[model samples]
Target: MAIDDLLDEHEQSERVRNWLKNNGAGLIGGIALGLALIFGWKWWVQHRDQQAQAGYAAYAEAVKAIGGDDLKQAQAKVAALREASPQSLYAQLAVLELAQAQVKAKQLDAALATLKQVAADSPMKPYADLHAARLLNAAGKPEDAVKLLSSYDSPSALEVRGDALVQAGKLEEARDTYLKAMTGMDVASPQRRIVAIKLTHAGGTPPGSAESI
Candidate 1:
């Protein structure tokens, strides 16, 4: 009976040792996994920041090239940044800049196309729409310009719409639109002068300008 008791005690000790060994391994594995997750998250964040920085740097270089009046080189750099990070803010801004450069180079069709794409997009839709409307107005499509500007509720859109209405011989509507724009205009804002001019041309007196009704 004593021997049997001794054997039983020995078995219990072995079981306890095995259990301790297994638990120790599990604990070590859990700690290692936690560390790996932390490190992995940090590395991912660093990588994302690096990508963003590189995209922004490329955009800056493109801007510098533009300042040097090297439109072709600037376009190439913008293309590369766009390809590298199509969803980045820098990429979107680069596209807008490239479109403007195209306009400066008198590549109006390309500019219009790019601006149209941006206009239809959800992220930059307002800006793109405004630019597209401006270009359209410059291209002598005042009615289309008005339609495009009407899509946005911004003060600039109101001013643009007023200009389009005036150009289209809708003087009464133009006067009303100009008044809405004038509500937020300061003296330094070109809209102030613009609204006053339209009002005078529409046979109305400008509030701050020395002009006849």
Candidate 2:
């Protein structure tokens, strides 16, 4: 190679070296930050998974606490689930289970209170309303039951509402309500047969029938 060519090649190498020396710390710092972000995201995902697992375990404890002679323990564990993570799906499910236990134990007031605590916008609202309406009817507050269940479209809720209307002696209304309930039920539901009988009873002479006027 020519001497000038060799000198020019060496100068180009020196320029690259100078550039690396000037920006090396910045490049290294950028790489380190990128690695930190990757690991930080993984750590957050693992932490969240662990928290959800723990929450699910706590929810199971609450459910097991029910269906035994340990009403107080059941209540405590369910309340703990809510306090630990009120926004969790498990917490909402726990509340619904707790209310059912309270109802089976015939603690009507406590059951109503538990169902009332469920937020209207929660995913469990329909279930809560159904349980509350039934409890109200059981407690001889059929009017309140009917009103609470008025906005719900569940087949079971409709049946309960029909029963409530029957108890209130609104026979015509009860017959129509029973019709609505039957439409929601599968033909195979045992409740369907029961509702059919109820419809027959509610479908006595119409108000404008000759027997009436």
Backbone clashes for every candidate come to 0, 0
> Which residue runs of candidate 2 sit more than 4 Å off their true CA positions?
1-37, 204-213
Q: Give candidate 1's TM-score.
A: 0.70
Per-model TM-score versus the true fold:
0.70, 0.74
Judging by TM-score against the true structure, name the best candidate.
2
Decoy 2 TM-score against native: 0.74
* Deviation in Å, model 1, residue 122 alpha carbon: 6.6
Worst 10 residues of 1 by lDDT: 204-213
lDDT of 1 by residue, 40-66 (tens): 999999999998788778989877776
Q: Put down candidate 2 lDDT per residue, 22-52, tens digits, no spaces.
A: 9999999999999999999999999999999
Query: What's the residue-level lDDT of 173 in candidate 2?
Result: 88
